[model samples]
Target: MQFFAPLVALVYLVAGAESACTGPNARTTPPPGAIVVDATGAYRGSFKTVSEGVAKLSTATGDSTLFLMPGIYKEKVTVPPLKGKLIVQGYTCDTTSYSANQVTITRAMAQNDIPASITKNRNDYTTTLLLKSSNVKVYNLNVANTAGNVGQAIAMKIDGANYGIYACKLTGYQDTLYANQGPALFAKSYINGAVDFIFGCTRRLGLSHATLVDFQKWHKVFFCTRKCFAQMLKQMKHILVTSVTQT
Candidate 1:
């Protein structure tokens, strides 16, 4: 009962945060002075690509935000370790769920496609977004690796501390979302994959009100090694896997 109280409180808090982050009442537009990336150039001084906007940010820019317009951004994005907090916000109509995510960072990189000179490992070759910066929050975005079950394709690779993902969608075949090293809070999100989708040596991971989908028809799903599970239970202080629906 003692442990259950705090757990319940945490779940309620996550639910409240989710409600606040989405819906018609929520703040639809990006915060003022945010680096805007719009494909159509509808917003003034907006970059055409996500990479271009990220390049403009620096250590001097305190508490920066990247606001993405509604479009499919087909490019490999890496948010290199930064100084202050960085918030990447995606434009969405129904911000309450991942189904309405308008911004997609997608790529078609597979093990067979990557050159031998780059990396032999399938994980390194198939990453769409590599976020190494601490104190980063990504909201209402869809990150996907469209290799179509070819090999190990990663939608996003998260490494660092104090990361949070809210109302987002991560989709791939194998090894979809990699929490390499960090303590991350994933709330109100949907993750879809076939094999070993959410496998990593992450220090701590908190999942609340999330949907984990196995898209492999009649094939085995949820592949995590015993060593990794043991590590997660031993090394991590608080590893919450609550309200997760497998579909």
Candidate 2:
């Protein structure tokens, strides 16, 4: 069974995904490009928590539709070695649509300190996504942690996973958008954060056909048409990101 199992979990991770075990009938078939969070064999409706849906699958890799019901989920989550063309989606209705909250894959430290996995990876200068596989995708979800009462934290953290983040909104206070590692693509997404939120934060990162915004007053928009500051101090190989437009 392990051989036939997905090499990774295509969690449609908004920068996260996890693997666990459950009943056979519980493997819900999420809609194409939708992330799942329910165990009804179909990606629809709400579950008690996000874990309820994730725990049902042995491995969450490959093209999947993971839909999450709108609610304030007070839980800490982690997508351990999750990979593939995954799409994490949120269940939204004009009536039940919520604006903000926190959903973390990292163990919170001080609301500002990245997260346990991030801290460990960064401190050790390791890979960002902590990916054990590839072709992973994420969208329409927030993945972060405010463990130490820091404040509104990151929305999506694509540490080191190959994927895409499309048509989503990420809200937080500090280090909001952590592309710590990304040989991936991010398009048409709303990322909110303060204090150099998305600067010198990731490597080998690619931002193509995407609309990026940094609300922080001090944060600069490095929307150059080339490889941005390739290193921590290289100063945007071409130009720097410093522009914004409201629609």
Candidate 3:
């Protein structure tokens, strides 16, 4: 009973609590100069690397922003439920100016498994963004996997509750975005996949105002599990799937 009380309390507190953070080198505050990550959210500090900032959030579960300084912060990250409310922002990343941001959150997940079975699951390995934490929000950032095409490499994989992913883009080749067993709502977000991509077999995924952009040098969207794709199409409308493409 005592343990139950603490777990219940944590869940309630997390649901109501709002944590916010920006990259390490985010903009400074004005007037009072209270440095903040976003408009209402406040900025915590400058993390030389994303791991440092993520560690801070893992320690502090409240609304806090970890402003990442403009640089190429390369590492893998996992967002546990204990740590919530993270806002990672950065400067423009392009080929021209080196000042651009190149934060690659890597995971050992492979890229080429026709069947894509439990044996080939990268959950066994470290990942960039492991959304085990519920009621979390990630904004204004780019998550990439530089592990060259070999097996089933995944970008953003979520298996939690009430996720808010906005104004951000996830780039990868195969199995890029995996939303497992979670009721997710993805808006104004861009997802690029190759085969059986965006594969959330069990989760009740609600994707509106989203872009399912695919760059399949061979085929745009292919379903390896034929029976599964047929099941998804049974409930979803062809027009609704096409509407996602418009975004």
Per-residue error (Å), model 3, residue 141: 1.0
Per-prediction tally of clashes: 0, 34, 23
Query: How high is each candidate's TM-score?
Result: 0.79, 0.53, 0.59
User: What does candidate 2 score on TM?
Assistant: 0.53
Deviation of model 2 at 209, angstroms: 5.7
TM-score of 1: 0.79
Cα lDDT tens digits, model 3, 1-247, are 9879989999877765422223343332221311222221234444455655556564445654544443444566666565545454444323222123333344444534334464555442434566776776655456765443564566777877777665456666566667775666665566665554576564355555556666543244433366655654444322223323322
Candidate 1 residue lDDT tens string, 85-198: 999999876767778788999998877777777644457557899998999999999999989777778889898899899999998878888888778877889887877778
- Write down the RMSD of all candidates, one decimal each: 11.9, 14.1, 16.0
Q: lDDT of candidate 3?
A: 0.52
* Window of ten residues with lowest summed lDDT in model 3: 31-40
- Over 67-166, each residue of candidate 2 has an lDDT whose tens digit, in order, gives 6654455554444555445455554322111232122233343333445555444422221122233455554454443432254344445545576664
Top-TM-score structure, candidate number: 1
Give the better candidate number (2 or 3) by TM-score. Answer: 3
Model 3 stretches with alpha carbons more than 4 Å out: 1-45, 58-61, 89-121, 124-126, 217-247
Q: Which regions of candidate 2 deviate over 4 angstroms?
A: 1-46, 60-64, 92-133, 142-153, 199-201, 208-215, 218-247
